[model samples]
Target: MEKERSSLEEMLDAARKQFLEEDLTTLDFKIEELESRLAFSVTTEGGDVCAFCPTYCVA
Candidate 1:
């Protein structure tokens, strides 16, 4: 079990490193865009809302 867990962890770490090296710039841009949109919504709508959480929206 320990060996399997260690192998799985190593695989996950490798995959994460690969993703960071390959796609981190795109991910960062997407995150920045989302943040910008969220900021705009908060400022214009005067509320805090997330599309994923419809039940607890403050709008």
Candidate 2:
């Protein structure tokens, strides 16, 4: 059976693809903005999440 990817993994994959596709100042992101965003998934902290949970978010 195929193992499901965690929320962090999903987020990382999306972020990687986005950064790769976007061409902005290369490594030194010319057009970068630091803003608060709600994270539907996060890396393991207390423990790994085997399934999705509600009301859990990060900003």
Candidate 3:
């Protein structure tokens, strides 16, 4: 993020594009909210499931 007067806007093109060009208009919160994910594959070398999803959530 970069400073412009007061609010911070996303600077990277790749990251900014994900927001559909909507620049930052508010403060960013640090609290977690309704986190969720899914795992459909695994890494054979580590035999570890992909990130975040519970074991049962994996395929």
Candidate 4:
């Protein structure tokens, strides 16, 4: 489980980097649409919002 979580985090980090380096307007719109569909908000801090799904939530 730890290995899988690490791999997933790595993938999400890569995707977030790619999104930030590319066309941001379109990507932000797409992310917003996905968030609406998923019914969850990506975690934000210090004005930086993550562009991936919210999978780091603790219960």
Task: Order the candidate numbers by TM-score, best to worst.
Answer: 1, 4, 2, 3
User: In angstroms, how far off is 35's CA in candidate 4?
Assistant: 34
Model 2, 1-59: lDDT tens per residue? 12355777888999998988765445445323221121324444535452355544342
Estimate the lDDT of model 2: 0.51
For each candidate, give its TM-score against the true structure. 0.40, 0.30, 0.16, 0.38
Model 1 CA deviation exceeding 4 Å by range: 24-59
- Sequence-dependent TM-score of model 3: 0.16
lDDT (C-alpha, whole model) for all candidates? 0.76, 0.51, 0.41, 0.69
lDDT for model 4: 0.69
After TM-score superposition, the amount by which residue 22's alpha carbon in candidate 4 deviates from its true location, in angstroms, is 0.1
Clashes of each: 0, 0, 0, 0
Tell me how many residue pairs clash in candidate 3: 0
lDDT of 4 by residue, 1-59 (tens): 99999999999999999887787878888999987965554433334444453345432
Candidate 3's C-alpha runs over 4 A off are: 1-11, 21-59
Output the worst ten-in-a-row residue range by lDDT, candidate 1: 40-49
Compared with the true structure, what per-residue lDDT tens digits does model 3 show for residues 1-59?
Answer: 23662354434655668575444322222111222112234443554556554553223
| Segments of candidate 4 deviating more than 4 angstroms | 24-59
> 1 or 2, which is superior by lDDT?
1
- Model 2 scores a TM of 0.30
All predictions: root-mean-square deviation over Cα?
Answer: 9.0, 20.0, 12.8, 18.6
C-alpha positional error of residue 14 in candidate 2 after TM-score superposition, expressed in Å: 0.3
lDDT by residue (1-59, candidate 1, tens digit) is 99999999999999999988779788888999999887764534435456555444555
